[model samples]
Target: MNTTPISSRLHIAIFGRRNAGKSSLINALTNQEVALVSDVAGTTTDPVSKAMEILPIGPVVIIDTAGLDDTGELGELRVKKTYEVLNRTDLAILVIDGTIGLSEFEENVLKIIRDKNIPVIGVINKKDLSQYSEEDKRKWEEKLKLELIEVSALKKHGIETLKMMLIKKAPYDDRELSIVGDLIKPGDFVVLVIPIDKAAPKGRLILPQQQTIRDILDNDAMAIVTKEHELKETLQNLGKKPSLVITDSQAFLKVSADTPKDIPLTSFSILFARYKGDLEELVRGVKAIKKLKPGDKVLIAEGCTHHRQSDDIGKVKIPRWIRQIVGGDIQFDWSSGITFPDNLEEYSLIVHCGACMLNRREMMYRISYAKSKNIPIVNYGVLIAYVQGLMPRAIEMFPLAKMIYEEE
Candidate 1:
């Protein structure tokens, strides 16, 4: 891929009331006409996301959302969509109309952002057009309990200051998580067992595999790629035993058998279980497979939407396997991309995809939501390995989760 994937980029969503210059601020932030701008209110009917590089922040996706104060039935729908954007937003800029100032709508949205624990910057846009006394500005800030920066998007004023603040507030500077980098050091060999099946994307490896290889290379490790059937021979022919053997979940059984016990074994999706969300929690969720009855409902969620193939892993293969293992008429529901189902109480278990198409924030939100609802949530790789009785081996690379799984 020539550009960074949307899932890997930081998600910065802009929120404000109608005529708050939210679109104009986005254009100023990007230094381009990223969103349609006009004097008209509610020009942005839907969330428009632009992926670009912002120097210190690197690759980031900035989203412009519809006004939360929109009225009528259609406006309500648009507002609902804007609310959904919070699930994926890493950073939020609550744009305030300089003339109107902060109202009940802004206050509510601010409360929601704080409850979600997302980093936010309050900005009063249209600074050039609206004039407020210093006392009035202080009063508004006091009411909102947030410091507001005065910015004129049309004048390109205070835009540099905002960018600097974004870099400082960026979460990754404090978080240390990696796909496969932490498992091995430089010059170590890592074998990737890829299956060349009908489901494999044409002319390229899938997202997880591609990202895994990139991470390995980024860590200065050597990556050896092979198919499932050749895994045995590939391991035998290697000059040195690899530090780890990473395989697709579909080839778990065969890859496990071929890989020596000395070498750690895991799958792309399993690594993602840690990289994207909570690995220990997913490990715990795998145990719920034994509790699933024939009539239990399982929600299979994906981070991206796509046309389903006849032998699609999420739609067909996963459901078929779960049925064979559970041995009953289990109900399966599917939710994909942007919005997760709010009817979470109806489901017994949630089987999420690897979340390659979602940022860490959204993935964590889904997992936490499932926890709040008291439902077990496991990802595709973890569930598959657990059902196949290879979960311990699958998670051997991660010590804490593996210990927890084995102990319990």
Candidate 2:
């Protein structure tokens, strides 16, 4: 049950007019009939997303959107919906009917894409049916202000070229995780407190934990895994002081108290916060916790699926802790996966999960969304630290971030 959210995967959007082989291109690239292909215009009114492992690109989410050339009032609505996809789209494949040169609709979409500064690959589809002379191909390239690649989705032509182009255009996103490894020296000991409580998944560790361990090992560092109860003994049994102590958000208070302040201490979620390049903003959101009063509605947002653990952090523990800190009843709202409530104004504060499954672009979009609405948004680690009165202690691990907080 990997159940990892599709939002975490690379988002590649295929945009073109209806019957321009948008769906065909997707089928050819993924080697599956993932999306319905039809000669009829506007076959896909809504965005259809399919997750697959593309060669040289690993995991990616292919987004097939409605044709831009659609007409009528309904078509206008569909076009509006397609534009919304641009905000989160990492790469864009502008599929055009090879016979029909770039049309007004496609030109309009390209203008918007260019305005947003989105990386795009102009794919002249249906090349099998429409043979273009070398001069014509060069002319199309000059007209579009982009190098056009010929593709025949129906016959599965030019797919390998497309894949190679994607690898070169938007190379693999290696920075999906943070650079926390650089903070430690080789052979240094790093203890990770993974609380095997109700929230722990059944078969495997969560993405953040797994990635952290991988990062440590990649840096030639030692990672010690333990539960909250083993903190005291684990620290004592170790030959020397561990370089860092990373804990689950739920056990932040106890772990922070147990671990010496001299040694750096933080949480898995905080590591992810920095990995996504928004630690300073997250630390700012923690200040909102103090402003929350009794009966304030707080949104606990998790980017993944439900955990089988009985005391689920989003459902059970966070609300309980907030209630105790507020000294009164507080309403809690839970949002998991790609869904986020349309009406964000109602919530007093938003505490997001580590967002291990979401890419940096989407995470930044979420942070910006909250900021645009003037709503405070914080992550699990920052909120947990505030509740435990260890905000400064946890943030001490980040030197530049510590200075920002102290100045604020």
Candidate 3:
């Protein structure tokens, strides 16, 4: 929300070994001494991030990572932290010392990035002094199948070209908005039930609700917003029946009962799961609820900060509901805002909230991480449906999965 907007920002990560001029490259690119440059090895321990408006590309986060070949226990920890940044990175600049070319450490990092399917631009730094032969560059290019760019970070050369290349490489738009636009035809009515409770912010509407209305308007459809208490009267006063009703997951039972079963009904969280995350995985994650045993651990991950709701959904309602459904003791672990643990092997299942604030790459990375470790992940709506004995009705939006669930 600052002058440098986060919207549509490309996350550029710079990785290399100690004294590979990674820090100096960052300084040269930004046209300022943005990072600490030193001849000493392992100067940058933690990942340093800066946001700038690079023309053509617009806003972007430039990350300077620690040396991959760092030594000792602290060095290993730093390297581990650097790898974690890759999850959010959209583009990578692998800076290698021109004299030495590609080493085993650099190759290992490249392999990991390639495994994640992220694009990489190889930067041969210290071009001012090192006589890195053309033969070396050509041979490495042919071998690695990567175009090597010569850059003198000390003299600030090839910085503009790097920016241009990044813009050309990074994705144009990094968001998902399918259901809100596709479901309602032009001029059709869509009722959105938003509960104005303690959880409701002081003056602003939550992200999902605001985005839903915007998408409806974008599609030339009408969106009417009202609290839970007013929903019955609001529906009654309407001249025509709404094409669909979307409510908060917490208010699903009452809203479902109030709205006619004939009209299609779903929750904002469910729509968000489909829009910004993998709906099928979440639909499957709900199955873990049935398998919950006594003293099982469930991780509740929320993208936004927790609010002062009477029934704080993630902390209170979700745990309470799970216990009732499982009819046993279930321990809950909570994570809020921008942080998610690197290790997720401990939890039996992970129940995440609709990640409207996060980008697709980040969401998929989390999903992929859990899935690789064979841990199930579900979102608010799907989890609530399983709790409320309406798993079939709630997931009716996804036909194949509903059919599969029916068969199961």
Q: How high is the lDDT of residue 220 in model 3?
A: 93
The reply for model 2, stretches above 4 Å from the true place, is 1-9, 45-58, 68-84, 131-140, 171-179, 292-297, 307-311, 323-332, 345-348
Q: How accurate is candidate 1 locally (lDDT)?
A: 0.90
lDDT of each: 0.90, 0.82, 0.82
TM-score per model over all chains: 0.96, 0.86, 0.88
Model 3: per-residue lDDT, tens digit, 1-408?
234324235788899899999999998887778889999999999889777777666778888999989989999999888888888788899988986777777778888889888999988888887877899889877777888888889988887777777777776543534657767799899999998877788798887788788888989999999888888999999989998899988888888888887778888888878776788887877887788798989999987675546668888888998889889999889987656886688899999988876656677888888999899999888888777876677767678668756666
Against the true structure, what is every candidate's RMSD? 1.5, 3.5, 3.0
Model 1 regions more than 4 Å off = none
What is the TM-score of candidate 2?
0.86
Instruction: Estimate, for each residue in 88-196, the C-alpha lDDT of model 2 and write its tens digit.
Output: 7888999879877666777777888888778999998988898667798787678779888888999988999998888778745565454467679898999999988
Query: Which regions of candidate 3 fall more than 4 Å away from where they truly are?
Result: 1-9, 27-40, 52-59, 171-179, 304-311, 337-339
lDDT of 1 by residue, 156-204 (tens): 9999999988887777735567898788999999999999987787899
